[model samples]
Target chain A: MDLPSRIVITEEGPREGFQIEPGPITTADKIALIDALSVTGLSQIQVASFVNPKHVPGWADAELVVAGFAPRVGVSYTALWFNDSGLQRALAFRGKLTLAGFISLSASEPFALRNLNRDRAGQIEAMQNYARLHWQAGVPIAKIIVMAAFGCNFGGDVPAAKVVETVSDGLSIAREAGIEVREVSLADSMGWATPRRVAAAVGAVRDRWEDLRIALHLHDTRGQGIACAYEGLRLGVTAFDAAVAGLGGCPFAGQPGAPGNIATEELALLCEEMGIATGLDIEALIEAGRLAERIVGRRLPSAALRSGTLASLRRKVGP
Target chain B: MDLPSRIVITEEGPREGFQIEPGPITTADKIALIDALSVTGLSQIQVASFVNPKHVPGWADAELVVAGFAPRVGVSYTALWFNDSGLQRALAFRGKLTLAGFISLSASEPFALRNLNRDRAGQIEAMQNYARLHWQAGVPIAKIIVMAAFGCNFGGDVPAAKVVETVSDGLSIAREAGIEVREVSLADSMGWATPRRVAAAVGAVRDRWEDLRIALHLHDTRGQGIACAYEGLRLGVTAFDAAVAGLGGCPFAGQPGAPGNIATEELALLCEEMGIATGLDIEALIEAGRLAERIVGRRLPSAALRSGTLASLRRKVGP
Candidate 1:
């Protein structure tokens, strides 16, 4: 019941969806969705991922998408990049986007090996070099991201200790580079997180680093995303990473056609209904979800987009 | 968190799915689904709905479905009906099914008007007749169903008082019929339930009648069904009604393509993950969900079915 009065959502639909979708989704369409999400009172939006086009052909037009979309005044636009080459591309648009480096590590070693082609030591070495590059380029390492924080397809149930160890690895890398990170995003990359697992992982992380603000990057792959979000809220975790219309899928999780991220429209509804202000328009978010569906030329996994928000229903029903 | 040690799941996939599908679904397909659900360690299954063939042509073969499926030992198979004709139809299969009448009333009058064509007063009168018929036919009015107990499309926000009043009205009808109903099921008929609203309605009913067992009939229309169910679980509510693979939709809710009940597989996962025994085989349930998708000739709304179960993941990862 210790729900936060307000929660911050990082809109990841554009970045996540376009990266995994098997599409020649026009550059204009990608810009259109990001522009649509920009007006929904979202404080932050991940507009594109600067990954190699050979790996993810969907995000090939990343530069066009970033340069094309209209960025709002209050919204902090962000982008995802793994290596220095990707980072340099993102750094090209410094003012247009809020650039920060992430010490991203996978909680499960097997998951890291499959997705990143790196073992535990190899991942740490990569991040150590990544941290130094960010330092030399003067980009702040804002957070430590532990992928597969809950469980994994390759390694199965990830103990909270594994998450802590991952974070510790990230922290050591940050320390070597003389950088301080305050936030940690626990990602359910394989969609294996339940509420109980969320509680355990969040609790374990908090027990180790009491001052580090926690963020959940949950997937709806098994449909427990919102419930897991609810559990996080109960624990007073304020930051979440979500996709509008549930845009993103784990390309490396070995689950195809399973849902991607939790829907931002539904998560916002869950918050607003419980009297927790999301500071976003529910109707507008639903419309954006519909727009996302149209862009992808298929219905996304979000049921809320179909049923609509309660605000509209209340208006129809009257007082 | 006073979670129930064990919970009961009533598999309503056959009845709920077949009723709403615009299907020329064969009677054989329907029985095959029921038979699949029977071996999944479920204790109760709602096999079919006996309604007018002219209105709901999908369930025209309800008689054949009930007669066709091989009932497993220790499993209680049930059927739904609104009037005496439907009840008489169910009575035809006395030994084949567990026959119990439900005093189903809508908490919202306008919702009742749209769905049942009965106002608050008219609904009471109809249920009075319903109870008497069940008594005469040797069927116990086992529970009072409060539909739209959280909120409704036609009727805005249903207050806790309204739900209590609906339950009170049902109790009076049962008392008049000399029936002692022990259970009250609060249904999110149009999927307007949040955890807070569930707590309110569930608390209101329990405050008035602490002795009665509470059951939740949650729909995943807006994707908050599992979260609401988690809230119910925390409140020690033990019984849930679910559709395998999220097979049903509200035909009268003015919502097209919206998901119906929460998928039984996901709900069972939620319970089992929380250490609440559901006595359900998670793997078998996932298989049933897939079978449901195949029978419907389309992908159902359940993400868990596609992702499979954690038990499989554990096995894959090994101990």
Candidate 2:
């Protein structure tokens, strides 16, 4: 199948990428990375997370980072908010920030408790309450991120039925709360998804939420992230979440093992080769990788930066 | 779709894996690795190459290595022969080797000159003449590998029509020469193949040769090997060529750039998790990885070994 003509990229380096680092990043570095990413032609950037500071100290200065950036005209700066309390924090800057609320429902009771510190039902209730509060406060939830939609770390294979049910539950809550979710994203939280599984999940969600814009947030832990993205692109998913330099790993998902999410440069290369216009500057993306590496005080996991692309290799060795 | 019932893994650690290393590996260590691999339930092993000693000094003692462990029930020991001359060398040790001849036909004039020192036509003619000679000598060419079937460094995007025409040509030549070709493999010499391209190529070949058993030899240079394998598996392919600990490279293809074929342990894990049986002992495979690292005097590229599997990780970290 031919690739899509225009593919939208959502840089997750500021939010998801920094959240999984070993130590907290200073607000200045976070803002610098996001500001650099804004000029890289990304359609959207997950700028920060509004989760509890204690839970994710790396994102403690999320508000400052969001306030610091000079937002680009076409690029949307998004922040992730978890529950009613997080939504309240997001609402304080709702008119000034593009907010994205995350809700995960794939885990069973035990896994949910371990990962989210709540049962599945409790998590669902928390999302419902957040949706109601956002509606009453006139806040726009830019995207509803469905985490672990493909599979869970503790729970082996998340059934497609459960994912469909969770989307349905979220839709019902949104309808009752009188809030319209602008887009929905399916995340392969633990990187346990295959291409076929990703296709099936995306297809199921799209079938239910026909009008909701779909995005895919994939982790490359098992080296299948690009493949999964290819499949998603084939299934008409144009937006994706990627970390610059492939920095970051899930503290819970990749505790002592596991690889991380797909790198932004690698993903852009894939799209570029397939004739998909991602509008990302490969050279600039590599520079962003260097900036990320400097902040982290070590090399990131980007293979494209470490090992140049095929086109670059061809040029370096001469024709 | 459910994964196939079983996957046939052809371990190429002994020959391809060691060929590109900087230092020399002792004949004893090579033999020990082959023996260790045998118990890991590999269906077949490319034990050694019968290339000229000048070309690859590492396999200069290929004859002795084959003689050391020739008789093994149920596991085929295939040796790679480059041309009619290498086929002659292989025939001398026919009593102790299961032979397979390799012919690369995916490159245009320039790349063919640099990679195989022969153009596409010259390579095909060499294979046809070698088939005739092998038939006369009563040597069974168990497999015929067509390298660079996906894409070539100098010549990009190997046309699917070219691959089909070349395979048909080789099959005709073998039939007329009274030599039976048991299997044929298509390799991604520069690792430039995507899943879509792979599916298209494999599907085209399958359409033409319904009776021919097909295998894929893929490199992970661009991290698409596993995804390509998954696509081929969905297309009903049973056999694959892999380098244990992911050790191998094609210097002519690109330097410090050409990654090895997909790791055997990763393939086994994918098959096992998808409900396919490879009969491979994952733990034993990790042991082989350790031995490979020691032999190569560096870290092997096997992800399963570096980052332990979920089961092994749990065991290492204690429940």
Candidate 3:
């Protein structure tokens, strides 16, 4: 199937990928990787998260990394924020940078408590308040990622009805605040999604929010990340969040459990092979994978990095 | 969709699985693993290959493993053979046990020459001759695995038309030999399949041979093996070839490059989750995975085995 020329790839290696690594990565290395990624044709780069430093020490240098990178033209550098306090820090940069706010509807009570320290209704209210405050300050919220839209590591399977209800609630709040939420991306935080489940979830969301752009933030914990992306692409999802070299893992999911997000190179290869136009340089993306490995001081979880692509394999074997 | 009461699982850990491992598994360990797997609910097991021992020392114990495993009543154990000479050794045990002949059809010339030392037509003629001899001798050929039916590691894309042509050729030869072929299976040697591609291949075989019993042998190298199985199951396939604990790798595909077959427990989980019954105990299967790992002196490739199943996870967390 033919795809759009301008595919939006949001790099999540810095925030999501580094967040799950066992050892701590230096601020300098993280900044260097993000700086390198900015020029690699990515439309959006998720630089860091403003969560409690104790909770995710990997992103303790969130402010430094975001401030250090020399923002490239046409690239939207964004960060994830949860509460009003987090939103306040995000809004400090305001017009100077693009920012993304995250609010998760606790698909399950345990996940809600663990992630947001609130119930489903309480979390929605919090997100609504944050969105309103951000709009009042005249800051555009580029996107809001609804975490655990598929299933939660703590909460098992989140009902599709709940996700739709949660999204509808958020959308209503955004409308009330007079803020045009550009995109509402669903995250399979636990990587429990199957292709059929992914298709159903994306189809259901599209059915409800006809005009809103959809993006998928997938983890490869259970090895269904790419399969989910394949389903999403078939469902006409144009934007996705991926990690270079598939480096990211969910911190809550614990060690070696939550694999990195879908690798950018694998995603590109999939698109290219299917006759879809994803204007990213494949070789450069592979180089990015290796670079990610160096920054992390360990091997990245990318399959494409380990197994060269068909084109590269052919070149090596010599046709 | 409702599935049949009885499902056939062909364990390929010994022959198909071990042949791909980097180092040779000792003959004693192979025999023990095969013996352990035979007691499981597997209906058929491809114990070993009769290929040249010098080429694949891993299978040098092919004869020993077959003899060591005490035959069970409902289980049909078989070995893979690449040529008529291999077929002769396979037939030597004709009265002693049931065996299946295996051949690979190359969609490209180079792959055919490298793998089987013959082209597609030559392989077909050899298989026909083997079938003729097996028929005259009253040997029941349990199954015939058409390797590289999806695509070859060396040959790139194997066109669906070529696969259909090969199937037609096999059917004609079976008809001429006056022997009713029990089962015909396709092997995705390189794991380069997409769900849509799997569906198309299975659909083509089903459409052409209405009475044909189709099985799928897949590798998890590209992480699409399970997704491919899900599609294959949707396409009405009832039989699958899986390795215990995902213990094997494709030797030719290089280290960390070729993953093992789809894990038996993972496949069983998919079947159970989809409301299809395979009459296999998942916990018992996991035990089998551990057993395989111990014998191989390394970890298996099974995700479910490494990460506890949902049920076990719940039990561990004490829901």
- The candidate maximizing TM-score is 1
Alpha-carbon shift of residue A37 in model 2 (angstroms): 3.3
For model 2, how does the per-residue alpha-carbon lDDT over B62-126 read when each residue is reduced to its tens digit?
Answer: 88888786456778788887666777777777656666555345434556677668776777777
Docking class of 3: acceptable
Q: What stretches of model 1 exceed 4 Å from their correct place?
A: none
Tell me how far candidate 2 lies from the true structure as C-alpha RMSD in angstroms: 3.8
Poorest stretch of ten by lDDT in candidate 1 chain A: A16-25
Clashing pairs in 1: none
| Fraction of real interface contacts that model 3 preserves | 0.07
What lDDT tens digits, residue by residue, belong to model 3 across residues B65-149?
A: 7677777777777887765667777776764556655434544555667766877678777777878776776655655566667
Q: Output the worst ten-in-a-row residue range by lDDT, candidate 2 chain B.
A: B310-319
Can you write out model 2's per-residue Cα lDDT over A1-319, one digit (the tens) per residue?
Answer: 6567888887888787778877667888888888888888887788888888898888888778878888888887777776777777766776567755654454334457787687767877877777777767667656666767876657656666777777776666677777776577787867767776787888887787788788888877655677688778777788888888777666777543345677898788777766788898876887887898898786565656644566664465454
lDDT of 1 by residue, B1-319 (tens): 6788999999999999898888889999999899999999999999989999998999899999999999999999999999999999999999999999899999999998987898989999999999999989989877999999998899898899999999999999999999999999999969999999988988999999999999999999999999999999988899999999999988888898999999999999988877999999988999988988889888899999878888788898887
lDDT of candidate model 1 versus the reference: 0.92
Tally clashes: model 1: 0
- Which structure among the candidates has the greatest DockQ? 1
RMSD per candidate (Å) reads: 1.1, 3.8, 3.4
TM-score of candidate 3 chain B vs. the reference: 0.89
Please rank every candidate by TM-score, starting with the best. Answer: 1, 3, 2
